[model samples]
Target: MKSIVPCLWFSDDNCEAAVNYYVSIFPNSSIESMSYYPDEALDEHFIGKTNKVITAEFILNGQRLMALDGGPVFRFHEAVSFTIECEDQAEIDYYWEKLSHVPAAEQCGWVKDQFGLSWQIVPYNMGSLIQSDAQIQAMMAMKKIIITELENA
Candidate 1:
């Protein structure tokens, strides 16, 4: 059992779809388990959402996460985001291409996926690179980070 895990609340009824999408994107990932709202509870509270996913436990890139179909009481925000540390430009490009769905939200290597989850596709050495004077300016100029440009900067 994981000591701590991130729980994502989904307003939509597509929690399974979202889990599958994330499992497909990351390596060593799989759906660990799933549970649905009881019929009595569903009838009493969920209304039309019968048999809907109440919670789903999954692993993404070896990290355990839980997804909850919690209705529209809450929403995802940029304040909470997952960072994908890429080994090189290829990995960065791959994650960016697969995860980025909202163009307007793309900025400084950060992107918002179709499910409104924000992700940062960054090179593993981004910390050191950002420490350089010119690299900071170069990063600010583009949405997706270019490793070569950072190296040059």
Candidate 2:
């Protein structure tokens, strides 16, 4: 087992939505398991409800992700977003197209999906060069490069 794991929180059926979307986005990713509520507790908030995916495990490009029907207490925002390491613009485009389903949420290589989850679709090498200079100009340059790369693709 890995020392730590990522537990994504969702409101109602959003968890299911994310799981399905992720499976479709990554070629090697698939749902490993999904445990729903038993029949006896069907009427409860989540008990016996198929919508409540107790535990859903999947992998995206060799990265394992665990999702749950964690209810509406927490929400997703740009403060926390998943960074996809892409070798080329095609990979970035693939993620961008899949993630940018909502046009209003699109911003500087960042997007908030219909489910409220934030994702940063970026080129892998861009981060290394950006880290070398945390200045505003360097950040802008990196963003420009990413946009240029995506445009060229």
Candidate 3:
């Protein structure tokens, strides 16, 4: 088990499905374990949802993460986001294709997945590339970043 892991909140009781979806997208990923609500633990509010997933532990590209079916009390927003460093444009495109769902959320390589989780798909050397003033301007105008454009800038 990881010392620390990010837990995603799913209000729709789809934690297991969401974890499986993420595992499918990234390499070196798998479900470590899953825990469901027990029948005896089900209260009146959760009478028919006894077997629903309460928590699921999974790994994505070596990063340990957890998903929780915490009910409809909370949701995900842009305040927190996961960043993926891509080695090339292909890598960027691959992640962007899989994770991006909201068209309007695509800004400067940041995208929101179907589950409303925000992610930033950036080149591995993004920090060094952004050192140049021109590159910064080039990046500002793009949704999904193009490594070649940043390099040329």
lDDT of each: 0.91, 0.68, 0.91
Each prediction's RMSD over C-alphas, in Å, is: 1.6, 4.1, 1.8
Q: Over the stretch 45-135, how does candidate 2's per-residue lDDT look in tens digits? A: 5554654566788877677778877776777777888887777778877788777766676655677777888887777766444443343
Off by over 4 Å in 2: 40-43, 47-51, 128-153
- Candidate 1 shows a clash count of 0
For model 1 the TM-score comes to 0.94
Q: lDDT tens string, model 3, 1-153?
A: 538878999988788788989999999999999998878454677765687899998989999888999998998999999999998999999999999999999999999998888999999989998887899999999999999898899
Clash count of each predicted structure: 0, 1, 0
Q: State residue 148's C-alpha deviation in candidate 2, in Å.
A: 3.5
Which pairs of residues clash in candidate 1, taking residues 3 or more apart in a chain or in different chains? Answer: none
Ranking of all candidate structures by their lDDT, best first: 1, 3, 2
Model 1: per-residue lDDT, tens digit, 1-153? 538899999987778789989999899999999998777653568676767788999999999999999988898999999999999999999999999999999999999999989999999989988887799999999899999998899
> Which of the two candidates, 1 or 3, achieves a greater lDDT against the reference?
1
TM-score of 2: 0.76
Per lDDT, the best of the predicted structures is: 1
- The ten-residue window of minimal lDDT in model 2 covers 143-152
Error of 3 at 144 (Å): 0.1
